[model samples]
Target: MTTPAWENVSDAFMRNDKPYGGGAFRIRDSEVMTLKVTGPDTPFKPASEWKNPEIAEHTEPWMNNSGERLSRSTASFIRGTLDSGMTRYFQQQAQDGAWWYSKDWAAQYISTGWMDFTRQEPVNGLAPQITRLWRSIDGGRTWTQLKWPEDRNISYLKFLDPQRGYAIGWGPNVWRTADGGQTWQAIALPPMATDYRKPRKQFDAVDLGPDGLLRVAYYVGMLGEVRLSSVVYRLPWDKAQFEPDVVLPDQVVVRLGSTEEPPGHTYSIYALSRLGPQQTDGDQNDNGKRTGAISMWPGHRNPAVRQLQTFDERYSLTDMDVGKRGVLLVYAGDSSRRGAPHQITLYSQDYGKSWKDIDDGMTQGGWFDSLTNTQYALYAYTLRKRQF
Candidate 1:
């Protein structure tokens, strides 16, 4: 049967739990498209109910940080005006131990989105640090600090699994940990040119390919003439070292050139997509433009490893989630024209080949927390989705 006919039949059987008799099924043809039917006991939970109840009461107090109770006039204004759904979600997070608040900063986690960690206060008379790092295994209820070396600057953090992970900081170095954050070891880095007296750059982002290879991007040097470097390296999870395996095509350099003028400097390389050998071809005409074939090197110490074709776009990628089919790239942008209201954009369903934007309906102002599947009670204005 044609798709429409099949859909009609499917819908008819689903709604009545049987087909209409005498074949006179005259329900609007489009109505037949509704296949799933929800009943009274079909498990409907209000957005408020999904929140942890314990946290709900503290929502306003947490936001204002004032013990004073609001007058009826003020309370009515807030309730009738602001959309409190996001607030309730955040409150739940705090109650569940996923909500993190220091004297200087506060953050909550949304499942599978950008993990938004902001600096709440200044320590030792420094600026309020709004750095995003660390991952939570039990949702946002608790977070494990993923610090780098003696210095507290954490350039980036990537966890392929709960156990295997990699991070880099303000030096030409990468750190690896096999047992979560319990122990860490430094990875061997390739040599830079003698004139490369640029300050050792930090890895801005790291991603693991489906094949288990790791790719990293970072920036080096001072203002005006900063060098945004992209390096594709292979490290066996079994061993604690990284052997320079492949370098992404130089076209990346050209792309960066277009973004940053003469003395090119990159703001950030936030995300990476891994493509198969066939899709890596750079010469293929894309959107009516000739593109260069990206080069990929395989094997270690081969002296003469062949270059393969694969193309991937790196952005100020805020967060990345890899699925079975493709990778999701989330970056900071202003999708809405509400004056400086930034948002997280999703480059959805591209197998490192091409990206399409998706609208997941997130709000501005608040930062993203860790993504997980854990559920909790709703009590306050903020609710936190926990990771188990």
Candidate 2:
């Protein structure tokens, strides 16, 4: 636990050209951002088009729960004409760079709740999947979608009210939609169980708590014996089934808490981790250009291995937020080469159990969204940022 030298407080933050990732949320005053650019003829798109063509010609707004604001412009123009053939299959994979688009996506209205977003079209074909949800109705804005079927493939999303929310992903899949996401369930793991045919269990990380409870971490075995574990889950709103009663063995790279509840202990969960990296020595190729390091499996209990010489060593945690005292936003690196420089690490105070990273000044990868409370970012080169 002695790793602090993020290049000197990372220059005190500050790199807000607006665009961030693929997430952002905060309604009431107005805020909704999303990104994933490079379409219209491709070539990595982005010759400036951060939206506001008079709010894209006054349309794309949908809020209810009371925060008011309607005219989804016909459901955002029929989801933008069914996403124009998925934007020409992501502009031919961003014309060879593979993918890039997400400067942050947006949608908010908050009076009780209202957040919505959708995109999922690369299933067996792989890549491409985004889903965000939030809906509370003290009665207004008519929203409802949070139910959690593993949240489908939620890259990143956040919520602090209505019922509490949080989300993250790389693989082991972490979720906690509550009633806001309509339904998402899974939490309470850790007892040493990594062998899903190996492959770093695909990759996983997630955190959420304002009380509803949820914390997850993953990495099992097979690449120099990788091993990382963490779990904690207990989402009760009257319980209809949202398991993860408590599976803490320790491997939680980060976690933040609070979903309200206090009276008799209805919800509360927190966990964090960071100690996995060390197996470096070149040529381990995953192709997209190396950059994959997160190993950890040597005597367990706070083992070591992190940021090994950094260099496209693919790493990932996620933007888990509890905000204002619990900010945990971690987006590891490695984007197959070509330009690198997309590292997002912002851990503020406790929500991450204990961290201080900050430095969110880079772009390229994409993913991360928060609703109700407000914060959105999406990228792959489409660039979008919203805080206002």
Candidate 3:
């Protein structure tokens, strides 16, 4: 059987699920769209209850940012989600094999198309994709291609406001755009020292801090290599040269967040010690295919290991976000089990010391992969349930 046009979606992530105002954002057939939700009604029905939602026609074909072919790109169309009600953006693939942001509800939006990474080829007999930056102030209803300076691939992109933002690629340097990416300037990064081997930095997280600093995290290991530890660097708000490094123990830091309350500041970090495919033959949940131990570090303190059953092969941590409300955790369960794809959102009001399952009477269906929240509202992106 063929998947219908309405169902041929890569993701249907809920932007919000509140009673009065909530909806979802979806990427289907290379088009970015939304499901308008309006209600003060609590405890809505399953995701299946809603169908044939409206879609925005502004979109492009799915492709990797690399100088690949016009075919399907290995990159996920929508990588990250951020919505502050005023500023909404989606991190996705750029033209020349890098990730860029598409401000969904912004007055000025930007996107890039396919281009040759190397100048050896005449960019489909034209200019390279690196030289062009597409922009649209009218929320992507239209676009205008512009020019750029750097040709580097952005591994991490974070926007503190509509204008102030930071981006970093494979290199150790960081870039800033205070005028909504209209112009970019390179910033110096602290030198990373490797014990013996050359550092292969894999950008993991980049976030804006309360003290007007940019907190960046990366592991010094190549892809698929065993990572010993990770490093967190703090970039000052001003263009001053100060590198504050926080090196972790012998574990790969999968997630990093920080919260500034009153007396002092605390950094919430999630590190994984072990991970592998669980053996599943008879019982899917009983296997250890995705077995791994996740530990948390709440700034300058000993790590707290959450010795829970769900953290075993049956459940895998998918996403983590921290805000004024607290830290939110989204976990994906083994889809083999019945009713296992329901929303699994956990909250840790007291940092990562303890967490509470807060998915009571919420939207149901599929694994919640990415989650972001405002001071009062929380939004999540989920993959639809798999059919047998």
Candidate 4:
């Protein structure tokens, strides 16, 4: 109920132009709102140009099937031009930094969790919070909040091709959302003791395999207590659910790739993990920077974690994306170093095993925010401030 402390934050995603026409989504206000760019002629506009863009309001309350009142926030999670030329977007009511969807935006999903810290004593030794899920059909112009049971607080949602998808979070429970976010069915997972005090096993990322199956990746205490352990749960698209859980050593996995091109949508999944030692206590890099590394799974079965030695060490790799155009990695080299651009980007055709430079020659101060891929083109969003 408290107003979130606001700072000027904005970002944009570009859809590659066919040598002529392209589009972009300018995200602003912690992703609560966006300014859209329809393309070929639309150049990159600075945040100053859009300090205050046009705004609109909706009249109806966002509602779910169970008749619960789901209010819509002015914010949005993502926006872009779909391959069909339909401008679409999705967002949640609560302010949390996570999202799930298809690359095409045919099906979209998002969730929210409310924290209650007023209790003198923590429930189950952890602050109590409730989560909800929501969906949008017409590019976020309107929303349909889905009905979930009182005990459920869903955390993450990911969809493959708009029809096949999965959700995992608070229950650490695995859910299937095949009807394009309208409803979900629970698929039982290995039972871990639920403690309100201890940290919850969070589901961080999910990817589709090349064989057209689903693979989910999650971590336990990897970023918190310094005990690094993660698991990749694989499920087929057709069966109600069967678990093929692949567990890995202590490392935080973020971006996952497939043996075939276009990443996230294929099988034989390969993933990127933070390398070197992570701090044993606390969060947010009090320990130090983790050199980047890549891990691969040849298939949903018995995949090994190996160091990708070919990745260049010159730049501190920070972010990554994979698509038909290959892989894109963001580098934020140390400004303290004698001669390095404040930030730059690199690309890889053969996955993360090797990388090549793709800098736009901006040497002042620019940081990569997000990389998006559509069927025909790839887009990158970055933030830059004048050195002067």
Ranking by lDDT: 4, 3, 2, 1
Q: Per-candidate TM vs. native?
A: 0.37, 0.24, 0.50, 0.57
For each candidate, the alpha-carbon lDDT, in order, equals 0.32, 0.33, 0.44, 0.49
Candidate 1's C-alpha runs over 4 A off are: 1-152, 157-164, 179-182, 193-200, 210-212, 219-229, 249-321, 326-362, 365-388
For residues 1-388, write the lDDT of model 3, one tens digit per residue: 2211112232333444332222234332233333222211223334454443443221222222233332222111122333322122332233323323333545433333334443455534445333234444655445555456545545556666556776665445577888877788877665442222323344556655545567666555432232445556667667655474465434344566555444356545454333432232577465344554445445443334342223545555555555444444444444345663554445554445555553322343322212223212222343332110
Best of the candidates, TM-score: 4
Q: Any runs in candidate 4 off by more than 4 Å, and if so which?
A: 1-74, 77-92, 97-106, 114-127, 161-163, 190-199, 210-212, 218-231, 239-250, 259-268, 276-279, 282-286, 300-306, 310-318, 325-344, 357-388
- Number of colliding residue pairs in each model: 46, 84, 11, 11
lDDT of 2 by residue, 1-388 (tens): 2332321111111123222222221112232222232212112224355364333222223222212221111111001121221111111111111111122322221211112222243444343323333342422223443344322444555555544455544344445555544556654434343455432242344444444333344433332233433433334434444454333232333433333334454333333344333222463742323232222222112333322122233444443443332333444543442464666554433433444343345653333333332333323433343331
**If candidate 3 were superposed on the true structure by all CA atoms, what would the RMSD be?**
13.0
Tell me how candidate 4 scores on lDDT: 0.49
lDDT against true structure, model 2: 0.33
**Is 3 or 4 the stronger prediction by TM-score?**
4
* Displacement of the residue 170 alpha carbon in candidate 1, Å: 2.9
Whole-model lDDT, candidate 3?
0.44
Tens digits of per-residue lDDT for model 1 on 1-388? Answer: 1111101122112222221111101112122111111111122245475466554332333333321211110100000111211111111111001111221122211111111123343454333212233444542345555443433334445455566666654455666777766677877764441124334444434545433456554322322232333344456666655665434432232211001112222211123323212122465644322232222232234434233233223222233433332323334343234554443344434333544443223431122222221221111222222221
lDDT for 24 (candidate 1): 9
